[model samples]
Target: MLLTVSGPPGSGKSTTAAALAEAFDLEHVSGGDIFRELAAERDMTPVEFNELAEEDDQIDRDLDRRLRDVAVERDDVLLESRLAGWLAGDHADLRIWLDAPLDVRCERITDREEKPLDQVIEETRRRESSEAKRYREYYNIHIDNLSIYDLVYNTARWSPEGMLGMLTTAIDSYDPDTDEGKIPVEGVDYDF
Candidate 1:
């Protein structure tokens, strides 16, 4: 079962995806982790690397291509990324999207990163804006579109445990016999 967990930063994507992988006995690959690793390799922070990615499109292409390949090549895997759903295409059994309001997400990020609320908010806003523009320009993907996802949850309303339980229930309850199959993301370029 190839599953995808997707959302903006601080939406608990990595946390939930990791939990899902453990529960389902699946290999997990996180695009955020990969990006951060790459950033560190160059002695740069994620925000700095993101700015570089905005200039050099290959940075995103390489990362996204690897993620897309993993989704296609691996069966028992949980792929988590901003574009995992779109990149996974028809290969994924369940594509989940998580989100929270901006303020809620900013608070989560502040707590996780141990940063000031205002600084985190500014960085997050800039990062999100840069990424959205790059996604649109490079792949014709609109990051705001949630129609292709099998599950879309707002993280603000639930505790992390509650959210994970909800996701596990959905994964556990999937019935291929009654399954309608994936919703094709129309007009996505998927060039990366």
Candidate 2:
């Protein structure tokens, strides 16, 4: 089972993914962590890192390939990336998209990074705008589309455990191994 979790920055994607992977005994792969490592290796600031990411398409491709390879070989893998679900293609068994209000997200960012609230808000806006434009320009898919996901969770209202439990139960309910077994999420068709 390949579970792809994606959301805006500070939306608890990493936290949720980690919790889900731990609770379900799935391998957890975080693209943000990978990018951070890459940035540190290059000795770049956040803006520099973003520019480098834009210039090097191979980084994204390699990460996509890694996720695909994991899906093909692993029984259960949980991937957290901005574009994980879209990149996973048919290999994604359960895809979740988390969302929260812009203000809520900005507050989370400020709290997490201990930055000035205004600075965090501006930075968050800039980052999200860049990501949205770049994802569309590069992948020909809009990450903002809620219909692309198997489950859409409003992070503002749900605790991490609540969200993880909901997603896990949804996946288990659809597991073909159970008595009320249903096909894996890969078999489910999306209108898109």
lDDT per residue as tens, model 1, 165-184: 99899889987555576587
lDDT of 2 by residue, 114-189 (tens): 9899988887777777677666666676777666577888899988778878877887776644433222333222
C-alpha lDDT of all candidate models, in order: 0.92, 0.75
TM-score of 1: 0.96
Candidate 1: list runs displaced more than 4 Å: 178-181
With candidate 1 superimposed using the best TM-score fit, by how many Å does residue 62's alpha carbon deviate from the native?
0.2
Prediction 2 global C-alpha lDDT? 0.75
**Model 2 regions lying over 4 Å from their true place:** 177-192
